[model samples]
Target: MLSTAAVSWKEPNVECSIDIGLCPNIKYKHKTAQRRLTLFEDFVAFGGVCVSWRLVMAALKKDFNMLPRVPWLMLAEKDDGSNLRDFYCPMKCKNIYRSMLPKASGKRFFSSQGWLLTIAADHEVNLLHPLSRVQILLPNLTTFSNLEEMATHCTDKLYHNFIQKAVLSSSPSTTSDYAIMVIHGAISKLAFYRRGDNAWTTIETWLSAYSDVIYHEGRFYAIDCWGRIVVCDVNGSCPTRGQIMPVMPNEFTHSLEKLYLVESLGKLLIVLRQGVTTRDDYTHGTTRLRVFELNWEEVQSLGNRALFLGFNSSFSVEASNEIKANCIYFTDDCFEAYYSASFADEGAPNYHPEGGGKDMGIFNLSDGSIEPHFRGRSFDPLSPPMWVTPSF
Candidate 1:
């Protein structure tokens, strides 16, 4: 009661407007002293809190110096409702954060290791690192070989589903001395673009459909649908015919088994997954899996390492305490999704008219149980959810 007479009349909002958080110089000094290896997304989330955090974000935007963080479960683009694409930062946040990515609008996405490859409606191809927003333009889809053979298909339809996968010899951020390889066309014909090339140079493996490609050691190794590997070098005026490795037999019979070629702990592996396409609803389900080395030795344990495979580039990670060890994390790589997005007039089979996302989960080898990775609406046909390893 006595405070009314003694207290001064001042506006709290106006008087307390100055930043109470750390000063810019102090913030930066602490950052330097701690030397914390911060995640790109984590810094973004921290920016919304106060003025000093925003300064940190500004510093990050100007100079991004961090390695790839834990794999983020980037969900599919939403329906016509919003531009916000949701992502689940697995080991970092364990929560969903929505981001507006207009650059990816209406474009097909393929992963080149940690980076993303986007194909525009005009057939313009671009390699984009989403976190860093650094982009490199490659020759368009029309530049690929055998375009004359696909005269019947519309340009939109052909370019949308043409690229099966893309792999980078080295990250474009670190150095310019690198090469890019893409498995494109209906038959998965392999092509490469190097540091000094104007157009793509095809490696005439003359094999069946290729599923995956990886750059290991000093050469590029590409595996086809029938489990045959062709090793080719990115040297010479034109690539000599690819040297064929002996075909590894797929004990599990599916049209195109052994989709992922992953090199973990200096050991190359063939992950065999058998899934049947139910044309009724396009609900593809996998029941059996075999992850084995190229020498036909079975992998019984992964120790502290985890493997991630999907529509994006397949890679392995050393697990932290927050993440599960010896678990295989997978995402939606349903080939039917592309046809559904591109082949509207071509009488493509409808995928679950119910309008829901595809199947993605983690399989524990020790327990043989499956668990959901994310519970987001990732049903966009043109651009589905994929595993994105964040890098700057």
Candidate 2:
């Protein structure tokens, strides 16, 4: 007959089994012994590999709970002449964070891995984490000898004439051995810099006028205005061009307003934005948003993911049931037609002078439909709305 203690062991949380009818049976002893032996075998199997199976389970639960509930989109606007206010996603809420940038003249050029890449008026690049108020300053713009030559080429606006975008290989919090790549020069040259490097090294490539650059799979890939992709190895003193991706479709290369490269789900994607020139300004009036996955010799569909495009950064995430797949969320910048060149002196190339027509919204890829995300808020031209993925 099984003992009362053994019966209690069979009930995980019960202090004791009250069923006297089954507890006194000798068969119950065999069942309880077999169950205990199975549990012991499991513990013995996993014990050699880890300190405790319980601890591993606890650590996994903690990590799963730490995942963000929802990603947020970030927008920057001028509160006064010098101060900038940051608005979080789902704009109806009162949650807004302010920038810690010392100079109001700074412009945001890139955002990734929970950092905002900004260029100050004095031509210093800084990485700022708005949520944590952490910042890192890279080597100054004049440190690059090639950039100095490019500056002399356009002496009137030396600082503003170069550096369209910059991207980092990894987050500074993760490792100290990170690299930075920038699309610089009037003709769109690629420049590379590592954490310990003294100056930026310009990569040699056949393509001219790059629209965007992204660091993916331990290397940097850039897309030119004509939708050509070039690969660069950043390990060398100067980046070496590795291979050019397959030529983009004629529809993507012709009349392209802007090109963006984003890494999602272990695949590289190119976002081609096409718009029409309206009067003196460019209006994205019926502009089509097309996303293509870059294969070895051809392009494919994006498949079940939504892309967010901005001047500083572009990213993709799996679409939930609520948010349909194959759609794009975008923000207005200098590439859009409503942007005026007269606002260039107002601080940063993206800054808007009139502070109207931020043109922020979502576009559906399945069907041609556009939905505006923000309705009543007015944003600064210099600090237009941008999509920011929240990270710690």
Candidate 3:
């Protein structure tokens, strides 16, 4: 006979948030080296219980890896039965807006050229400046899409089609910004939204089957769901002029999914991902992260470590200034898949979002090692440090 007692997990406060800034005298458990950030408070540490270096090293030894001083975000259970909340660290203005967003999930905030672009699947697109709260809704996207029937097709396609790639680009013209969106399913099309133009332009030039897109030099290079890469010059200055450049042959297993045009230490990087092969000879559909150099001299592929991206291949790649440590910051998801229990679908075979929400990490390009990221429950605040460069 079995005891019929109920098993219940305790709910935590889930109250934590981070204020990205610089701090001095941060000492980690494993090393005597005290590192400092060029951007004073580049990163803020959230929700971690600091322990002694001896214990940290001991933990790493057992895990066969070194422990990082910073954590991306931290999670805590809510005291009540309601939803979880985040209390960000490195501290901040204690504004209502900061409290509204949990440490793990939200639309990514992108700031550039004095303008900030905010996107959330559930919310209206917003363009603003961080210093100022006045935001404007991008002239109704549906209204413009409906004008050409592209909206109807696009709306219908969203339910069936998968988002293979979506990236933001600034053309050399400087007058406009675009969102380069590509989809994979029955067919493929290269879609771009010109800011000032207020309408989307779709191109059926490349077969929408494969995956990967990166802006390198003056062109936007995309790898489709069919394992073919097409490079287009947004500047229209190349000899090929919008011609897709065919490089590596597609004898490999699964189609390519990601590309990184990483500019590090004065070098341009081209990182690609190919699926992993299984022992039974069936492709597991897991992607292996590969690196390359993109320069006029000779493009060279670097590193052979196969990183397990852990999804059926829906992911996003981004880079942050590893200012002090020479690291790379990747969001892993367009949506905040890192948090939110409601978004997770356990019944699905591959229970993960393609573009957002997986284990986000920072790879040290200098040493070829993956930094410890997304520890504890939510992202540790120290994880995504503020990338502040001295203005003067």
Model number with the top TM-score: 1
Alpha-carbon TM-score of each model against the true structure: 0.82, 0.72, 0.48
Q: Please provide, for model 1 over 1-392, each residue's C-alpha lDDT reduced to its tens digit, 9 standing for 90 to 100.
A: 00011112231112112232334544442333322324444444444345565565555543434533577777777667665556677753375655556777777887765688898888888888765456788887777666764575576576667887888888887778888888887677899888776677778888998888888886788888788888888874447469899777565334554467887898788887666344445566655556878865778888898888877777888888556898888876766543453345456555554322466788887877778777655665666678887665
* Steric clash pairs (candidate 2): 282-337, 283-337, 351-381, 351-382, 352-381, 352-382
Sort all candidates by lDDT, best to worst: 1, 2, 3
lDDT, candidate 2, 289-350, per-residue tens: 77667742334455787787766566777776334477787776543344445345455454
Any runs in candidate 1 off by more than 4 Å, and if so which? 1-41, 47-68, 80-83, 236-240, 250-258, 279-282, 341-349, 353-356
Candidate 2 TM-score to native:
0.72
Prediction RMSDs, each to the true structure: 8.4, 13.5, 13.8
Report the number of clashing residue pairs per model. 0, 6, 46
lDDT tens digits, residue span 1-392, model 3: 00111211132212222211222234435434332322211211111212232233223232322222221122232334433333222112211112222221343333322233444444344554331233545533342322344344445323222233344454212334444333323344554444564644455554554445555555566655444567665435442234655555545324445544444444445555433222243223323355554432323322322121221111222222321233444434322122222233576333232332234455554564555444433322111211111100
**lDDT on C-alpha atoms for all candidate structures:** 0.68, 0.59, 0.35
* CA lDDT, candidate 3, residue 214: 52
Question: Comparing candidate 2 with candidate 3, which one achieves the higher lDDT?
Answer: 2
Q: Which stretch of 10 consecutive residues in model 1 shows the poorest summed lDDT?
A: 1-10
The superposed Cα distance between candidate 3 and the true structure at residue 123, in angstroms, equals: 7.6
